[model samples]
Target: MMNHKKILGIVLLVAVSISGLFAAESANTENTVKKSTIIYTIKGNAEETYYTMMDKPIKALGYRLPDPRKHVNQVYKEQYGSTTLEVLSFMTIVNDKKVKPLLEIDPKLAGFNPFNLVIYKHQGKDETVISHLTADAIIEMLGITDQKVITEYRKQMEELDALVAKTFPSAVVSHGTYEGAVENAMMHYEITFDRPEDLDDYIDEIQEKVDDTFTEKGYIMAGFFDYKQGKPDLLPSYDAFWTFSLCHFPYSYTVFDNEGAMPEVAVFAPCTMYMYIKKDTNTLVIGMPRLANWNRFFTMNNSKRMDFLNKLDKDIPATFLEIGAIEVK
Candidate 1:
């Protein structure tokens, strides 16, 4: 969580220099994006009913929560014996058919194929906050330009936003202004590998190395999905495509578990990194929303969070390079 009154707080402080924003467009860029994150704060703690209440409606709207990291507060408490949050969830969501059209124009959209739908309740707080990055922010970050796809995507956003309000009528809805959002917010990378007779063999070997690398760096591969499974034709642009829901425990605990730490940033938790190989190409492409985004969206006023963000922003790409991947712009 970026900033929540009765609210969100997130981390540790170390002296570290932050990186430059990915693109320089923010300078001359008109602040056309009104909000980067949308928040819905209902009067009561909707912990128990959160899922059952919105499950059907979310799916009916073409979104699916393949993996909802629910009750994460408890998971943290077990590790540290206490947590500032009573409820914290990272619901990674996707609208396959709807996103299919956009993927054709911008494969980068897969960077957030399953963006986090965040919900949190600080301990003793009576209200639950549900939030996520706005569609405009996402579309802009990916540099999406197709009008038809853009219109349809925004329409879905309206539908989803309306559904959230309908599900929690008395909720107070608000959005975080996108005044200083960094353009091209995603970190893109690529790795060229020799074509092997059996791609599975390559996947098996590299996947093991990738897992080991992240683990050694104190990162958690919380979830993995081969989007190609059962839907090979779904993404004709790629011979194989997948994503990793990555998380770093110490970083999370620092920003979210402490008594006064911000937990609302949990909405961006378990960062999703997308990987794919375009048909007829031997290069493996990868992309993920940058940790710097958390800084931009939430302003990350505290140096502690800035430290963690800076560390990971540099470390993640280095870790990939250690495994033979190259940063692409």
Candidate 2:
């Protein structure tokens, strides 16, 4: 027979143990939502090294080094006021042959087809950083579950990493992954437009509308791609397909500059969006990878960031409507 006090003590001990267990479980859940990045830090001037790398061709890597955009000086200064920061948006489309199977399985991969890489440093800083999304991150974000496809993506990524290592032999390559709360990995917005008398004219009209809308909202139209003009054999089977890169510098600066926000988030920068018309169909389809994904994928709990992103998410679809796009319920 136990005393009343002893029984009470036992009950208290059990309650405490249960509480600790729940706390630990919550912590483990948070840890699994992290995202990883591969970072290369160079000791020389960022702009000088960036231009040198850009000028060099990467034929050995199966793609030519495309021209890099000078975003900091050209776009950011106009929006964020003048600053010494220098940022470059470097892109290179993987060999179409290499990504054919993946595309066959999922056409959405085209949104990220020409991979985006970023390099940045303030003029005064002695160190420059080169960063891009890891192949693992891309696969996860793309929601690819096929083990075979995942393996191939990893192989390609490793090859690209090896090349980067060779290019910056002396630079330090490090990794960073976000270990915070995870939210919806991908947010998609889509709308359908009635086919006009002239397809080309309609596309131009939509493009002009997107340009005007995003610009009005303090964003930059970083780049555009006419997929129909790409390799016919390896590309998607769309009758008329196109994609564009859009970036809001101030929004970008807030995320990249904040220590709380994972810098690796830039891997998804300059939002890659798509629009297309199906063969024999008069409907034009337009869509974008939602921008709020930044907070969700990175597990950013900051209320202010979430508020801004929420507004952006709404604004994007609103832009579509403003351009006479009908929401594809």
RMSD of each: 13.2, 6.9
lDDT of 1 by residue, 86-145 (tens): 788888888877887677777777776788888898888789999888888878777777
Residue 7 of model 1 has an lDDT of 33
Cα misplacement distance, residue 218 of candidate 1 (Å): 1.1
Model 1: ten consecutive residues of lowest lDDT: 10-19
Tens-digit lDDT track of model 2 for 1-329: 99999999999999999999999999897677454678899886666655555554445556543334556444545656654555544454454446656655665665565666677665566887887777766666666678877787788778777877777888898876766543445444454657777677767887888898889988878777766664444344556776777777677766655335334566677777767666657666665666755655565557766777788888877777777677753
- How far residue 124's Cα lies from its native spot in candidate 1, in Å, is 2.3
TM-score of 2: 0.73
Q: Clashing residue pairs, candidate 2? A: 34-178, 35-177
Residue 131 of model 1 has an lDDT of 89
Query: With candidate 1 superimposed using the best TM-score fit, by how many Å does residue 282's alpha carbon deviate from the native?
Result: 0.5
